[model samples]
Target chain A: MNPLPRIPSPRNPAPLTIADLGEQGLLQRLQPFCAPGVVGDDGAVLQPSPGQALVVTTDTLVEGVHFSATTTPPEAVGWRSAAANLSDLAAMGALPLGLTVALALPSTCSVAWLEGLYQGLAQCVGDYGTAIVGGDLCRAPHLVVSITALGEVPPPLVLKRNAAQVGDAIVVTGYHGASRAGLELLLDPDRALTGLCPPSPQQRDQWIRAHQYPRPRLDWVPWLRSALAQGQSASASRSFAAMDSSDGLADAVLQLCRASGVGAHLVQADLPLPPGLASWQGLATALDWTLYGGEDFELVLCLPETVLAGLEAASGAGVPAFGLRRVGTIVAGSQVTLHGSDPQEPGRVLSLDRGFQHFSELF
Target chain B: MNPLPRIPSPRNPAPLTIADLGEQGLLQRLQPFCAPGVVGDDGAVLQPSPGQALVVTTDTLVEGVHFSATTTPPEAVGWRSAAANLSDLAAMGALPLGLTVALALPSTCSVAWLEGLYQGLAQCVGDYGTAIVGGDLCRAPHLVVSITALGEVPPPLVLKRNAAQVGDAIVVTGYHGASRAGLELLLDPDRALTGLCPPSPQQRDQWIRAHQYPRPRLDWVPWLRSALAQGQSASASRSFAAMDSSDGLADAVLQLCRASGVGAHLVQADLPLPPGLASWQGLATALDWTLYGGEDFELVLCLPETVLAGLEAASGAGVPAFGLRRVGTIVAGSQVTLHGSDPQEPGRVLSLDRGFQHFSELF
Candidate 1:
């Protein structure tokens, strides 16, 4: 068998190894992101906010299975792990506070690589004011990093999975399919000229960075929470069912419906597709990517029809800024339907094979 | 090359895969150890006590590096992982409340095996009053389980590694070396008849169980807290430094000394050995294990001479009735010495070829 290929060191003045990185390296990377009350050592400490509850979530990334060793950088892996957990916190409209990371690395792994990974993780945490508090170190057959994040939600602001109602109008944040486009670029580099993948170095960098460090929608939490709390009517306040979309819009919408025990109707014309993909063929491909691609980390929300006014009021103030657009609505049935043109001629809802199945395809 | 040996299924029932066990089965198994507020879908929710702080810790166990697939059962691996983290909590005199588990399994791994592992983990959690809160599941090259446990301690009751003072007496809870002896038995099963190993089936079972599922000394937390609250002199309360002896007594003493900036003098004759291992050769072997073997999971505590009465008053009534012994005294310098009859003549301190190293060794 061929010997394992060595990972290249970052182009810098000095290189470091796993031992050299140590606890200090981790602390340096995470310290900037930590909130005032969260401290490091045992775990990130979150002082209880008087009227809020703490929301915690965890996600793990394994080498090879999650991403090929040759294709994905350690820094991207670190960033993604933090982003994934933060996404969960954002889904609950919670303020990200701190995180603990447990890392398992092969003995031969260099310290420099680990340090770079921390750099990426630190960048994300710092961006969101989340501290890297505590974690474990161990040897393993392959590289694995598990991160648990803690966030706080004011009692009145907590969004749960089971809060959607039959008449709720569904809205989503941000554009979709960019990460999926980036994935296609990585998997088939030759597909660049087709406009499916960007060709220039700058474009490549943008795509790669998007794949590696997609931001969590934490900034939108306050606006969403405020709108939900107004509570004049479902439409008067901003309250509705909300969750982050990680495993693509299709799966996320399906999950929301399942939790609410209702069905949904998707308006194809309302989707926010990325630039330059306009023709039906192009749109269909992009839609496929948008529907089932993973790691978008945006929010898919269900708002009561009464709260539509509150959502519109928030949008008018440029609060959500990108603005929430209606993509679907909850109905009385148990299946997600896609609407084309005429109400009498509803189009067949296109279903892609499962999105990202972590351990098994069963889910 | 020969194919890897298949994991053995128990004789009485066909092995169940993780899918077969589902969420409820795994939760049911883990429910016993967790307090009412511990488990939740988002993550375990722990309520911090008044004037108390939360202590969080995480550790991961991999299939081959942490345990041998053939020799160690999956259940033991799961149980020990929880035990190890809880031990850290106990060292701080904290009560464990909840834990989140992230599991990475190869696609071919059986669901039943995962169920058994959860059963073991759940048993330990139930025993500790820790709830299973939340976790991530993913596919990987080998089995990997990462657990994060949350614990609480009154601020005044928190014991730290840096509190040992010169002239403080060193105390240890429970007997040492049994785990090392059991490990020796596992490595060389044919040595069962030797006095170095357990002599009977019952003794052997006990030894193995102790190694596999050692209980964290959480019962001592309340007693330690009470001792702290009684306003004993600084020479008594402030002098106490505590940490778990996970990496054998000598190493633990070395770490405690490093943390406290002091040395210690151990009485070789006072080193407690497991019962029935008193013969000259057996005692020597047991002593070696006690000094250098890993995974004892007992507490090594340092306190002033004045608190001996308080400790004695609390023992057996709350603390485990087993071997709590005075083994050494803290000194002003930075050396750890083993003392014999001649206090003036320095005793020879034993050294091992290597200390316990994780992951890197395998690679």
Candidate 2:
């Protein structure tokens, strides 16, 4: 039998990795941040809330596809990974109950990086009043984080895509494209902003932060529910359909319309571009990016026109804080049309840019 | 901008890949297999069972790590992945409610392969009386499947790892070592059986089937509860602790002991070897593999001494079917010891093999 030569890694002496800690040690590191008494069990036991239904959403983020390992901070990657799932639950008007993070790590991944990643996941989950209840760890060629977030909402308020009425007002909770721009800057920090009407350094930094740490719209849910409830009569049932624009605004709009069997008329002039975008539209194409770029983690909602009057008057809570902007209306046709600034002219059918195709595309 | 020359393939214009389908087309493919009315929404809504606590567990299986892309069939891969997580819920004595499957696929993955994978996943999930409630798909350099299984159990019967008493009898449902031996054959089908005292062809086939299609002990759960209840009077409380042997029997025993804060005395003669393992113990080291080799997917349980007499008499349903074997007894201490066939000899401390460390090793 021939024995292979052993080559010890001595030159650079890289940082301590998860491999060095082993499963038990790595679990020990995680137990403190995860939900108390949840990590040691066969599975996390969550008591069901009476009269409420449970909502579950899952999302996966791969190392190179979702965030560049070398360029992006580990904690920010963790934050964004968790935010993606939490945003889905928030879109359904469910408050988070807990989360289970399943990670597949590479041998080269450092323990410090893992710690920072968990810290980010825990912080985002904790910020929304939930804990990391359970998780599984294993090996892979690259880093992969799959988070399944469990949330709860009353059965009546459990939002669905098909609930939008024909006379619904299309709304957005916040600005868009900042996350895409942030991603561009992060990928090529010194270069991606060279086009006409580049964002200021401060604006670029904000965009970077938006991309790195986009918060889920969980805080806006309670306020919206309360605000909408106030406007309706005692016996009238009320509902507003919503979906997160993680796959860009156009994609979300198209999905909502398709699911609801309705059409949407998006007004160009009323587009809620990130601050200062209206002034700088020529060479930058920021408006195009704003409408098409994804990962904003903002909710695109549809409120019934009848309740719109009441909701507008019932505001002050979630209204000013999240900057809910009325973008368009749900029309009768099935096509999503974009109307120009001129009121007399007919609208053009919006072309669909395929968003985030698995196996072929990346963010 | 110079466009790269399009090199068209003339020979072997391969089958339809997931890239050709895109994300929307892929969702359309998955919609039917997933839970009815659960897909096409921001998140899945599950009506919580009355008076039942929810149990959640997650597990991941990566290509080349958990399953071989070339050797293992895609459907088998899917079945094994779901089984891994389902086993966790089964160990906790919970009835599955639903599951969320998040997959990260490579460009090379074919749509046919994906359909088969989902079919396998759906079959296993459906067999256990649940559906794939939600899922997310994205691009990755390799095939990755992360499944989060949700379950429900009455609060009192929420089997946890910490409920074992000092005098509890350690029991295992079904056999062990077959999964490891099966893996051995699958990895090197031609040469793995060359060692001393290899099994018959039928036995080999059985072992391989065990590896590819191991079922979760969900069927045994109901019987377990009823059996334990039969011994206790109307007033006395009854419960047992359990954990899956996915990380091998020894690892499961060690973990159950560590989590419950009790030591165990494993009888060497009483170890539940898979059908032909005890006979093939010399060069093949089947007993060693039985104890240390992981991915068995059987449940290791701890039943109170008082209930043992009743449970033994309370058989006929899950007993003969799954071959429930009593292998050890829980003792007061922190160390897990293995006693020799000669009961007079003092037992020796069992050395830990550090089962299934991520990023460092693979089966």
Candidate 3:
């Protein structure tokens, strides 16, 4: 293992653990990331835009369970945690506002690790024009970073999982399967890049980066808002539904269907596999990665016929459309079915229990 | 140890671990505690009251560090976590709206543990009319609960630590030493109730409860709002400063003074000791506990003479005044001094390093 790279702190004379930077010192160092007049008070104050309803979500990442200390850097851990929460806000089609972090670290954890973690957090928030606000720091036996992100949306524009209806087009933004593949690359002992698996170094790096820094689909929020507004006219996707693929596409689709009491038939061929997967030696492994790989942080929206047509027409226009794919359609049932070659043939009906169960997966 | 107590869940038919409930099932079980229409969506949506400024605070409690599974019940663990964050809101005189909890528990942890924790959380929020808006649940090696509580306050009525003024009266609501004494009873291996120390069973229980469920002073928010409003007038206590005594009265006083760029002179004789402490054996021990005990969840306010006059006159009429003692005064210098007997003699000046150093205390 490599010795930790030294990250200099302009305030401290090369301190070791966070203990070297006392509570006040730590707060002072992290204050720059906070919104103005928000870091020192008992609680930070925020004023939402007029007629806006605030959207909030929290996600917790623990060492060893969520990420490996050996494989993933502290900064990436922080970035991913923030990204997970931001993705939830994006799923709601809300504009990112601010976030508060509750971080607990072991006494042996280095000050450099803390700095790197905050730097990553700062970078993510900086990109979205969001402030860190104030947060709590404490001691724990291991590392735990919990982030709560707050955003705002016009009340009528809020997207929900229970809004999906029959005949709605199921569309997903961005490519899928990369994050899970990345995890496999990092964890698989027999992988070529680690002198055991077949993948090249560049492929491994791309996959790993996908897992570490999954982009929260904030960029697609404007498009979603525009679609939602037009759909409210009773001629678009007025019964629209959307959710982020954090628990893998299959599981997330099932969740949305179950919530809305509808079924979905997703086409396997239409599923966007991670680039270069065609050269992979195993078909089953790649399929599994595409179908059930969690942490993609991509949006899956159910659009009515009118909105679907509009989106399809606007796809090649000024909109930032990359991996947007029309994968399937909502149906009148409770099962999620997947079709391979032909839609007329029998499809593979998937169960809710097939995907990532956070508790079961941890063990 | 006694076998785990049976806490029946009418919702689940004898579930064992979280996996049995599954993610959706678990969310459904906990949905009753959340605000209406807020739990099922990707993110909870909240509409803050018109003209209100939202206050947000997050606090995390870790197993082995914040509590012992052997000594503290899961309900108390949840209760304390909620209380800690709520206390921060009380310090700001904000009316709590809702809270989102991010819980990471071990896979082997019982379903009953999760139920008990939420039950306690529900009770706290119920008492204040605050809702459990939503939360995240996941797996960890140990229990870690992070809560982000949201509240609202009129901007003009916001309480701040940096608002303290020179010659202002330093007053505290409720006693402080009891919490530290409780912690000592819980942590000291040679304590009487544990068959080694001199304290009785009743005394031990009192301390344990104090440590486990420190009440947030939501009941006092109205009085604070009224005080802050009246103080806004030219003749009232315009230089008001306030914060919670989470890190002992001395430490909290020092923090308020430091933030305000002022000093404080506290009289030891005026410090309110917990009731029945006269029977205790040691004066210095009791004094140390009173001066440096953290987690008391009491409010310490620096009030001007005019505001103090109005508060004193209105105390018993409508306010729930308990242990409201004038312990000291804000001074001109940057030191916190305590006079044991006479002010003419040299006093004890407290340092910022005295209490609740999260990292240093852990080691």
Candidate 4:
């Protein structure tokens, strides 16, 4: 072997790419935010709690398709990417353990951009009591961030989409369609920070924040599990079903219906609309947004009436219960009906309503 | 709600994109190969074995960078992506539980291409006694497959890179440089089925196959762990360390050395070179490939001399022991010295040589 020349190392101020950081250097920079067991190794070791099952989920975000570099900041992109996968865990009523992110970056990307991304990721993980354990870094023509999040749930209380029972009350936590409205505001061509919008600055900020920095609603998981357990004792609901309203309320409900081999009768008046919907010109537009808008990251559940009563009682006692509205009921059929008035009448079929379909409009 | 007009659906023969399949449709297509516990819900639930800790690792593959569409088939891409992460588990002596893949595909991508990719992935997972548990699909301008694999290992026996001690013998499983040679053969512009190569067809095929379908050497993990335990009892060896040589022999050795805060004295002649290299022109070129080429997916272990003895005895007894070759020893210095002959003479410093720096010459 011949002696190789040692190359001069690039300083922080120099034009930098991931290549300059190398795999080890990048790992070193990320070490501070990692959990105790996530040493710089091939895999992160985790000890699952006793009688708990591991829950794993992944989500991918592409540069042009998922977010526009011109509009979305690097930090928000990282934040939302983690948020998406964590929301999956929330739907399962799992306690998040940690996350792993695999990022492919363009060679022209700067070191500052990567640092900002990690900063945002760390913020989200820390806020949720989770850590970013380990990940792979590669070069590509564009940016892609793929996140895999791990969580733990008690085996008996594991929530699934195919567990809904007929006659179950369908409920949702939080308002619907806010994220879609926020997405529209962010993508609007004529919207300066303060121009071409009827909403106040606070309302505008709320919408944009909801779109870019959506929180995974994991806080209500314990409450939901307790309610379900009590329901199983008092009622013959037999099963529990829950999922995230990521692809709009109508689509998520339809998905739950499809998986559970059941149908639903949703009352239009019972659906929770965003408070800012009053600022819009027409109720139809607000309804459309609530029905077909995506990325809300809220939980939709099918519970027995007994469970709903227990939750309402908890709320009466000021136990900070999740504010769930009874929007529908699981029925013995194959189609989901969205009813405006009389239940005896043939209502509008919502099963065919599409939400945010990727590769349809963007790509 | 008003009745919405039903849109005409595109037929199978029509131009179909991922949007037409929809997320649920794509998942249904993939559901056949999933494990028993992997319910089509928000996340895949896994039960860890008793006394076992979970190990998680992730890798990302990007089109036009990690693999070329013109040169590599979609199945090979999927197979190799899973192989890379599984190899990380092999390094840690862990049993693979399952894998989660997050894919971003272009709108123009064909359904046939996706089927081929999953076919390859399913075959690999089945061969390893693991399963495809869950995944997410989205749209992108280019192809990106990010896989996160989970494994299980007893906490006490978990292998790590930072456990090497002074006087530890360095050994590697399988021949080095085959994958690099195979990669070169695949990338060669002039190689028509039998054109311009000095090696036999069998040898050429070996090189290409090694590159495209490298397997994680997990069969020998139990043997290595047992050997280490015996060595500790019989010879009082202080530590043991191992890592996958995914980044070539020289760089992997340097990485282990760095993590253990030790250096190495490696004998150039003692390194294991692939048998196919004899069909090449010069020994120096073969040595360079063995030393600096990456992505071999072979294990490199820093073990006590006593453990190597135990492993050799097992090999003699007809047990499936890895083909181990003693190449070097851990030393109490900061620089790795690759010596040709005389130890006192000037030797090449291997630490300065970089291997497979992504974006160095490509972009």
Across A94-203, the per-residue lDDT of candidate 4 in tens digits comes to 98989998988887777767776777787788888888987888888888999999999877777889998898899988778777778888888344244233665666
Better of 1 and 2 by TM-score: 2
lDDT of each: 0.70, 0.80, 0.80, 0.79
| Candidate 2 lDDT by residue in tens digits, B1-363 | 212112222222458778887777878877887889867987899997899999999999989888887887767887888898899999998889999999988866887788878877887888788889999888898888999999998787778888777888999987888888888878778744565566778777777878988888887788766665664454267566899999899888888888888999999888878877656556247777888888889989898765665666666643666567899999999889888778888787765544655644542
Cα RMSD to the true fold for all candidates: 6.0, 8.0, 4.2, 8.3
Chain A only TM-scores, each candidate in turn = 0.84, 0.89, 0.90, 0.89
Instruction: Put down candidate 3 lDDT per residue, B206-274, tens digits, no spaces.
Output: 666678777898877876676566767855545468999988888889989998999999998898887
In model 4, which runs have C-alpha deviations exceeding 4 angstroms? A1-16, A36-39, A189-197, A235-237, A312-322, A360-363, B1-20, B36-39, B189-197, B232-239, B314-322, B359-363
- What is candidate 1's CA lDDT for residue A291? 76
Compose the digit string of candidate 1's lDDT tens values, residues B1-363.
Answer: 222123344342655555454443444544443444333333433345555566767888888877876788767777888888888888877888678888887766675566557767777878777667677777778888998877777666677777888988898888777787777778887677765444666555556666887778887777776665663544344535788887688877877887788989899888867665455237667677778777888889888766655776765455566846899999998888887778788876543223454522223
Sorted into a CAPRI-style docking class, model 4 comes out as medium
> By descending lDDT, how would the candidates be arranged?
2, 3, 4, 1
User: Which of 1 and 4 is ahead in DockQ?
Assistant: 4
Model 1 residue runs over 4 Å out of place are: A1-46, A195-206, A232-240, A278-281, A306-321, A347-353, A360-363, B1-47, B195-198, B231-240, B278-281, B349-353, B359-363
Off by over 4 Å in 3: A1-15, A187-205, A235-239, A311-318, A321-323, B1-15, B185-207, B235-239, B312-316, B321-323
Write down the TM-score for model 2: 0.92
Q: Per-residue error at A305 for model 1, in Å?
A: 3.9
**CAPRI quality level assigned to candidate 1 from its DockQ score:** acceptable
TM-score of chain B of 4: 0.89
